[model samples]
Every structure is written in C-alpha cells, then in structure tokens.
Target: MGGSFKTQREVNGLFELTDSARNNLKNNAYYNDDLAPTKLDERTWGTYHIAALWVGMSVCIPTYMMASGLMAQGLSWWQAILNIALGNLIVLIPMQLNSHAGTKYGIPYPVFARLSFGIKGAHIASIARAIVAAGWFGIQTWIGGGAINAALSIVSPAWGAWSAGIWVSFFAFWALNVWIAHKGPDAIKFMESWGAPILGVLSLSLMIWAVTAVTQMGGSVGDILNLPATYAPGGFWKIFLPGLTANIAFWATLALNIPDFSRYAKTQKDQFMGQLLGLPTTMAAFAFVGVFVTGATSIVYGEFLWDPVAVVANIGSPIAGLLGALGIAVATLTTNIAANVVAPANGISNLNPQKITYGMGAIITGVFGVVMMPWKLMETAGAYLFDWLGTYGLFLGPLAGMYVADYYIFRKKTLDLDDLFKGEESRYWYKNGINDKAIWTWVIAGIFPVLGKMVPALSFFSDNGWLIGFVVAMIVYPVLMKNDTSSLITPEEEEAMNEKVTG
Candidate 1:
C-alpha cells in the first residue's frame, strides 16, 4: 500500500517489504498470512500498549503464588521478594535484546530463529518453546477453572458437595481460552489493553483486604514481615542460587518467544521502555502481596492458605467469594492468552505454514494443554520450584543464549528480508533447510545441566541450570560459527541488495 519495489524503504528501524517482494513470496511453501512480515502501518503498538501487555502478563495467579513457593523453600519475606525482583532484572537484558529483532524485522519468533537455526531447523527452537508454553497454558487454565469452581460452590451448596463439578468447570474455561486465541492477535491486544488497568486495581484491592483483615484480627503487618524462615537447606547461599535460577526460569519461555509480541511494537524505545517499566515492578509488588496475604492467613485461619481461590472461599460471604473468583478469572485470562497461547500458536504454524493456519495451531496447542494434565505439576511449592522451574530452565536458558549471541554478536543485527522466505533459494536454506551447527550447539550447551540433575556431586550445575546453559551457549555457538559467514550481511551489502530488488 505504501509503495512499489522502486520506492520501498526503512522507517523507524523497521524493514518492511514492497509490493513486489510480497507478491514474489506470497505463494512460497514457507509463506502464510500469519507468518508474513508485518507491514510498516501494521506496527501500531505504542509504549503504553507494550507496557500494558507486560502488566497484563505479570499480574497473574502464578506470580501471586511465587513468593509463597520461595518462602516454603527457605526464604524469609524480604529474601523472597528480593529474589523475585533480582531474577526479573537479570532476564530483562535478554528480553530487550530479543525484542529488538522483532521490532526491527517485523517477523515472529519462528522466522527470527531462521537467522541462526536455518529455515526448517528453526523448528527445534520454536517447538521447544511451544512445549513449555503448552505446559504453562494448561497450568493457567487449571487455575482459572479453580476460580470458576469456587464461585459455583458459593452460588449453590450442592455444587460444592459434588466432586465432579471441578472437571466440568475446567473444560469450560479451557474452551473459552481456545476460542479467544482462535480469533487471533487483535483479540489478545484488546484483552491486554483493557485488562491491565483492571488487574492492577484488583491486585491492590486484594492486598488491602488482606492487610485490613489481619489488622482487625489484632495482627500487625510487621508481625508477618518478621516471620522466621521455616526450611533452610544448609544455609542461604545453597538455597539462594537455585531459588534465583528458578525465579529467572519463571519467565524463561517468554524471553525466547518475545518476538511473537514485540513484532507489533512501533519502535525499539517503545518496547524497551515499556518492558523495563512493566515487568520487574509488577512482579515484585505481586510477590509482596502474595507473601503478605499468605502470611496473614496463618493468623486469621490458623492455617496457611497459599492458593488465592481457597482463601477467597473461606471468606464465608457469598458475594465476596464470587467477586474474588471473577478477579482471578480475569487475571488468569489476561496471562494465559498472551504468555501461553501466542508462542505455541505461531511456532506450530511454522511447522507447516501453507496447510496450518494460526487458528488451527492455537487449537492444537489447547489440546496439548489439556493432555499435559497440569494438576500433577502443581502439587507443592517445593516441587513447583525445584522440579518444574529448575528443569525447564536447563533447556530454555541455552536457547536464550544462542538467540542473543546470533542476533547481537554474530550477525550484528542484520537480516535479508526477501531471502527469509525464499525456500531453497534463500541463504537460510542451509544443508537442505537445516543448520546442524545450531542444533548441536543447543544440545551441547544443555547436556551439562541435564547431567547435573542426575549426579549428586554435580547438583550445583543442576540448581543453576539456566545460568550454566546460557553461559555455555554463549561460548560454544560463536566458536562453531566463527568461520561460517554465509548468513552474515554487511550494511553495504544490504544497500546493494535493496537496489537490486528495486531495479
């Protein structure tokens, strides 16, 4: 719409194709409507919208439960909040780096992977992220269903007595998520923009309610803050290392697939500033709320209730319980659609872009979510931290390392827009559309962490798997890629190529 190949150009760091390039690639097997590079005019997300996206994602039920899990491990109230805050700051570096490629190229994560992973080989990176995302999708849906079941029990005492009602609510909530994701990206953007403010208000209200209830019971906020550490393993250093690693792994999935959302961002500053302002602050604040409320429960109910749904049910006022459930539902919906649904939907669509639509990929992701049976994954706080988060960290950290090294260090942030979709004709079509070096680099970097999990003497490696994997990839990928300049395009070369495409 803007111009033909003769007049096409870059705007605000974004490289968009002309009508000729679009027409030339439209019918290629690797091309699809969903996977196509976004036009310049399509990049509508401003700083506020990007910030709101993070706010919507960070203020969720699981984030609320994070401090409780950390405290159960060995951290005091202050230590837990500090760890949550610090982990987010560490992850922000990688998050910002990955977001740059998306905003600059207007390509999704799968397409971005093609820079280092090759065309077909990009699947290894995308699907690994998708699997983690699918698991998260199930966990969020389960939390939402729990909220729905809680509200139903309040409305009808008979429903509370029926054990089968929870399963019914689970599928109903699951279907709602799949339907919304099927509607596509605009639906998610609308949900996040509107939901962010409401979620902030809801979180503040819950915190106030917790504080007020505790004060009325003759317990002070100071008392909760001063709570002693319950379970310390050896000492603080032993617990701190793994806890920090697990906290970083909390958002490890999003760090890899961030391009899925950042592709819509208007500029580098918009995405950079928005995430900087949104992610760490919301996470720390919500972690504080979780620690405070769960601590108050020990005083108010004579037992600690880490689950917000259970806490709301025990309030005994039907109206209050219903409102609480609605709040949880909104929080979970905002997080599930953005964080869990988008990555897998785009990643699976990459597998067969011609035949598989974004909507179809979304439905498949939802089915996988149900099959994961996420309830088993949430048995205890310790299990959730050490087993689930730590283990996934081992895999995703190497991915983050490889992506950052390739985009920032090796290629120096330049990509050929037309060659990306050229199939065998594209430079990325390495060795029949697969890059063996990237695949081996990922496997090599991740192996140490996996071994750490098995060997008792190597527990340090397992506990800090995310750090280990990331560092290894950072060192290994460049050495393997040093002599291979096939993918590297200089700025002068890029200008000449542009002229050729225009002529």
Candidate 2:
C-alpha cells in the first residue's frame, strides 16, 4: 500500500481489476513477473552475463551481414568497421541513458515509455517497436532456413535440388525459433550465456579458415586492406552520412528495448561494463571477421560474397560446407530469439496486458513474420541496405530522441513508479489514457525523417534521419512540457506521498 493508488476493478468492462494490486494485476495480460518492475531481490544479472549476451547476439549472421552488406554497397573494409564502431559508440549513449531508468526503477521499456508517451500513448510506440522486431524475426528466419537447406543438400544433393526441401527446411527452422521464443526470457538468458563462448570460438575458426584459404589461393592479405570501392556514386558526405545512419539504426531496436534485459542487472556498473565491453568490441571484432571473410572469398572464388550462408554453401567440401552452414543456423537461432523475439513479445504484451502473454506475443510475431515474407527484402543489395535499415531509422529515430529527452531533460531522471500501473486518475493519464502532446511530439519529429526517405531530392535528410529526429525530439519535447508540467507531481503531492509512506 504505497498511498491511495487506484487499481481498476474494471475499466469500461475491459477486465476486472482491484485495489488489491497483487490479485488484480498478476494474472492480467498487462501483469507478468517478466514485465513488472524488478524488485531488489530480482536483479541478478552480472557484468559477465551482460557481456555474454552481447557477444552471443553479435557473433551472428546479421552482424556479419551488417558489415558485408555495407562493403557490398561501396565502403572499404576499414570504412565499414569504422562506421560500425562509431555508430555503436554513439548509440551507446542513448542506450545507457535509457538503461539507467530501467536499472534504477526495475521497469521494462514499455513501462518506461509511460512516463514519456503517456499511459496509453506508450502502446503506439510499443507496437512500432514490435513491428520492427517481427520483421527482423522473418529476415533472420529466412537466413537460418537457407543455411539449413544448404546443410541438408550437402547430405543429399538430389533432394536439395528440389524447392520442396527448402520449404521444408524453412518451416522446420521457423518452428524451432518459435519454440525457443515461446519458452520465454529465462531460456533466452540461458542461450545467450551458454552460446556466446561457442559462437566466439566458431568466429575465430572461421577467420582462420578464411585467412588460410586466401593464402592458398595466392591472394595477398594486403588486397583486403586496400580493396577499391565499386559504387560511391554520391559524394563522400552524402554517402557517409546516410551509411552512418544505417549503421546507428542497425542496433537501434536494442537501444529502445534494452530495458528488457538491463532491468535484470545486479548493478549499474555491471550493465555498463558489460555493454561497454560487449557492444563496440564485439561488433568491431565481428565486423572484421565479416570484412576479411568476404574479401577472402572474392580472391578465392573470383566473386564477392555477401551472405555467409551463400559463402559456406559454395565451400565445395561436403564436410566443411555442412558444418559451416549448420554453425550459421545455430548462430541465427541464438540471435533471432534474443534480439528479435524478446522486445516485441514484451511490447505486444504491454499493449493488452489482459490478453497477451509473452508466449502469445511471440506467436503473433511469428505469424507476422510469415505474412511479411521477409525473404523478398533480403533478395538484393538496395533492398537489404536502404529499404530495411534506412527506412526503419526514420520512425525509430524519433523514438530514441523522445525517450532520451524525456528521461534526462523533462522529468530530470525522476519518476513516480506507483502511479505507473494505476488505471485511472493517475497523473500519467493526461487525456483519455493518452498524452496528446507526447503523441504530437512523436508525430512531428517522426514526419521529417520519414519525409527525407520519401523525397528523392532530400536524400541528405534520409542520410541524417535518426540524428535529426533525435535532435528535434530532444529540443521540442522540453519546450512542450516547459510551462505545462501539470502531469508532474507538485511539492504538495510529494508531501502527501511522504506522509502516506511515513504514517
């Protein structure tokens, strides 16, 4: 009993709630042990665990694709690595700022969103996040399915020659992914911790293989260091700015939903050290592997290869090809479950807490994955690079800016947690369970970056979408809330709260 906080017994007959916080909220779709604010006793993750989570996620096909995809577009090996480093380093600032709210308050990102976006307005942002995660799930599934089919073909080439085998493999891999995601957060945590060391060892082995293969082909190692760019059709700033935007956006999903994991941190130091060690270093190291391996493939096979699955498929030796492809499949499995499924599941659950559980949310994502047919988006260079990554940066950019500005600037890093779950008459329920100001702020900031992408002449806007959107929200949000913090608790409310706690 943290004051006379209202928990709805019923909201427009949506579901029965009660002043009894435990009995009312626990089984409701909105209330889960996973989604609830973490009590002190629940914070258990250490720096090592956090670091491993990053490594497991980083040593995957997307990280490989992120680097290779950039090089395939026009970046030098060094340029691609540099951008990855810089994008990740810059993104780390917002990620850390967002993580602090979670680590201190023990709330997941959706709950965190309530402060910035209003109680129900947060759902709008939450669903946007879920959409991105679902799209990624499908893309990663296609990759894993392709790899599995390759391995199966090595075992039985004639069967692999048929399209039926690929379809079968795709369905099989999808089912596996759904199973892991459905098992819930604990399974994801276990996979990240247990799978990281294995994947890291595999990454080193792949690098060693690439270097040895290139050497045998009489390819100078120096060739990779100085490969000429094939497609820099635009000026450097034009190319670099847009390319850098894509890089920042690559992990932007995690930037928003990191609270899903960081809330489990045993200490802020652990989360900081773990992310500090994990993100840039692992991304840089993995990008290096991607650049080297793709370059080595060009020398050996006389064609640039972007997809690691495609590279492994043509390895020629049945044993090496099958094992390498299987390794990639496993890596994708770890990444899809950890990176794609968790955020969206939590987000979808946040939308209708009485109806959707994490398991149901995960299944909904799988259905969307099937409907989206994400393989088409990955079929070409432009589709993979700009269409997916650049476009997502448009909307997500505003989100990043809004969350950072709201927490750091407006509220001054302070929040009222008990009011967060209160159904009605809560200060957060500004207008009909939504904050029109926050909704409009997101819309205004979101429009510019998205417009940049649509208008062919304003490519510069697209190039700098996330950066601009973020800056706009940071500046605009403070102005909107400056004279109107009726939403915030006044000194009198704090005194009353204190009396309730003390008395």
Candidate 3:
C-alpha cells in the first residue's frame, strides 16, 4: 500500500509539472530560453557606437536615392534636407523607448513581442520582418557586387566581363558575410564598431573632395545648395512630413529590432545614451554630408547624381573612384550583418526554441537571402517593393500597440515572468497558446494600409501607414481583447512563477 501511494504521488507530480510547462511555453512562445541573452558592457560602447550606427544607416544608396526622389518630386534642396532631418528625429523616439527592454532583459525584439503578441503570433511578425531583411540583404549584395565589377574593370580591361564578374563578386562578399555572421553576436558587434568608423571617414572624405573640386571649378557652394529647390516643391512641412514618415518607416526595422543589439549593453543608461547619440545625430550628419556631396555633383557634372558609387565614378580619378566604391561596399556589408542578419536569426530561433540554435538561425537566414535573389527583386521590381513592404508598418503598429497596452495599460508593466514559460494552463495560454483577438486585430488593421500601398487610389495612405496602422491597432486590440481575461496574472502568482527562465 505504501509503495503504491508513493507511485501515485510521483505520477501526479509529473502530470502537474507537464501541464505547467505547457502553459509557460504557450505564454512565452516567441522567446528562446536556450539562447543566452547578452549582458551590456559599458566600457565597450559609448557615444561613438551610436554615432557610427547613424553614419552606416544614413550614408547608403537607398537614403540618397530617396532624397533625390524627393527633390525630383518638386521640393527645393533646403526643404528636402530639412525633411530628412525632421524625419530622423521622429524615428528616434520609439527606438529609444523600445531599447530599454533589451538593455534590461538582454532579449531581442522578437522575444520582447511575447509581452503582447503571444508566443506564436510573434513568429508571424518575425517572419514578416525577416522577409524584408532578406530582401534588403540581396539588394545590398547586388549593389556591392556592381562596385566590385566597376573596380575590376578599371584595374584590368580584360575583366570587362560584366555579368559574370558582378555575380562572382556578389557571392564572394556574400560568403564573407556568412562567415562573419556565423561567428555570432560578438563578431557582429566588433565589425559594427570598426567598420562603422571607417565608412564614416570615407563618406566625409568624398564630401570634402566634391566640395574642393566644385570650388576649383569657379562654382560657388551656394550654387549647389540652391539646386534642390528647383527639383522639389512646398516648404518644410510638406516635404518634412512625407520625408519624415518615409524615413521612419524605412528605419522602422532597425528601431523595432533594437532590442537585438541593446541586449548587449551593460546598463539601461548605456542603451539610452547610445540611441540618443547614435541614431538622431549620426543620421542628421550623414544626411547633411550626403546632400552636400550630391549637390556638388549636380553643379560639377551638369546632372544630378544621387548614387554615391555613381558620384565617385564620375570624379574621373581612378584611385578616388576605387576608394569610394570600396567604401560603399563596406558600408552596405556592415548594415547587412547588423540589421539584416541579427533580427531574422533571433526571429527564427524563437520559433523552435529547443531545435533552432543561434548558429543555425544565421545559416538559415543566409540561405533565404540566396533563395530570394534580392538582386532580381531590386532590379526587376524597383521601388515598388519598398512601397509595398512599407505596409508592414500597419501590422507593426498594432503589435506595438498591444505590447504597450498589455504592459502599461493592462498588466501595469509587471509581468508574471514565470507564466511566460509555463504551458497550456498558464494564464497566458489563451486558447491553446494563441491570442486570437490580438492576431485578428492585427490582420484586419494591416489590410487597409497594405491595400493603400498596392492600389493607386489608396496611395494617399502609403507614406503614413505607420501612423494609420498604429491608430487602428491601438483602438481595435483593446476593444477586441477587453472581455478576454486570460492575460491577467496577479502579483503573488507572478512571483511564485519562475525566478529563472529554463529551456
């Protein structure tokens, strides 16, 4: 009798433990307990890292192309410059706020999504974000490959094999990136630290060269400054609003995933200062210099040249052109690794917390980059995909809303951390670890904004999808999930939950 009673108690404990584990898993579906979170080291990064991030982000082909496009839209040069500046300011706010969690928990953005989106739903968002990142990886690779081809042609006329050389160079750089990324976060951080500074110096050098050349040609700096007005229209607000919105969306991926990087910071202050110093100031400086160089190109070349690589090629000096090409390639690679590789890797890792390791995540992400053939996407689709992808802001908006609402409005920012890991019976395991109200709200709210981008009649909302999606999600999520009380967890229950997260 005694033996049988002991056996029964053991069986009961096992069943209860399994049930608890299932609930925890459902609640924290998006996070991976297996991956060790990064602890920030205050000494390693300071204002400079932040500044370099902006330099790397701003001094890219897409940003310049967008600035030029805005100019072509009939806004004056000053108007456009102001627009870019103001736009960057707006993007900085949310980034700073979101980065706090990363610094505190050392978890990436997709993991953070579990606070609001439920575990599984976060994957949906992660996949969307990853798809966009993969596309960008391919596009940047293509651009870098072209630069290699151009440099090779100059070095040896026999290397004039354009298509073959371009693809070859593309694969070479792609392979290098794969290697770097495979080394994990430390490698990515080291590259960002060193590569960012070098790229900044090169960009500044290009600007100086352009200015000096313009002055020697008997042209005043004023002439170059005056060019943007002839191209774009309206004043600061008109240009500023669209430019600001577009840049915010363009930079949204970085802002949203900042936790991925911030998790490495030593303290919240380190993360905060890094964001304040890095994103806004650096982005502004890059924009200023970019506009200055492109303006000089307009005056000297007699036509506007927005692509930095093209600007360097037009300089007519072999050495200078080669240096410029190399700089752009380096800059693009830095971003590809930091922004493109890291976020998606975390996203995929979250999907199967037990099965997908960080190294595996990196490999899978790189493979997707190849399969997507980003070069084909950019060359064939043009800016249409960017516009289409901008619609993602709609989903992000609601997702963010749910996060802020759950933490601040509903749960009061005090999460039952243990419940996050428990299985089905977990208060968080709403309907088999899925939160239908949040998911449905996100889908419905995202549709209109996406349609706005695809349909010409709805293009008016294209540039402002972030705002639109945010507003809709904010209203819809709360209302839909109002009667659903499963998300609520008491303070005492939360404490009894787990003190440490277990894989």
The most accurate candidate by lDDT is 1
Full-model lDDT, candidate 2:
0.79
Residue 389 in model 2: lDDT: 85
* Candidate achieving higher lDDT, 1 or 3: 1
Model 3 shows how many backbone clashes? 26
How close is every model to the real structure, measured as TM-score? Answer: 0.95, 0.92, 0.84
- lDDT (Cα, tens digit) per residue for candidate 1, span 1-503: 11234323476467776678788778898888788888878888889878778888998888877887777666788899999999999988889999998998888999998888899999888998889899899989998998999999999989989999989989999999999999988898778777767677767877787788889888888878888776655688777888888889999888898988888888889999999998998899889888888887777887667788888888867898898888888778877998898889989999999999999999999999988888888878777777878889899999899999999889888788777876887778889899888988899998978999899898888888898888899889999999888777766567654533231
Q: Name the TM-score of candidate 2.
A: 0.92
RMSD in Å for model 2: 4.8
Model 3, position 335: C-alpha lDDT score: 69
**Alpha-carbon shift of residue 148 in model 1 (angstroms):** 0.5
Which whole-number lDDT from 0 to 100 does residue 23 have in model 2? 52
Better of 2 and 3 by lDDT: 2
Model 1 regions more than 4 Å off: 1-8, 490-492, 499-503
Using TM-score as the measure, the top candidate is 1
Model 3 residue 36 CA deviation (Å) reads 4.8
**What is candidate 3's CA lDDT for residue 23?**
36
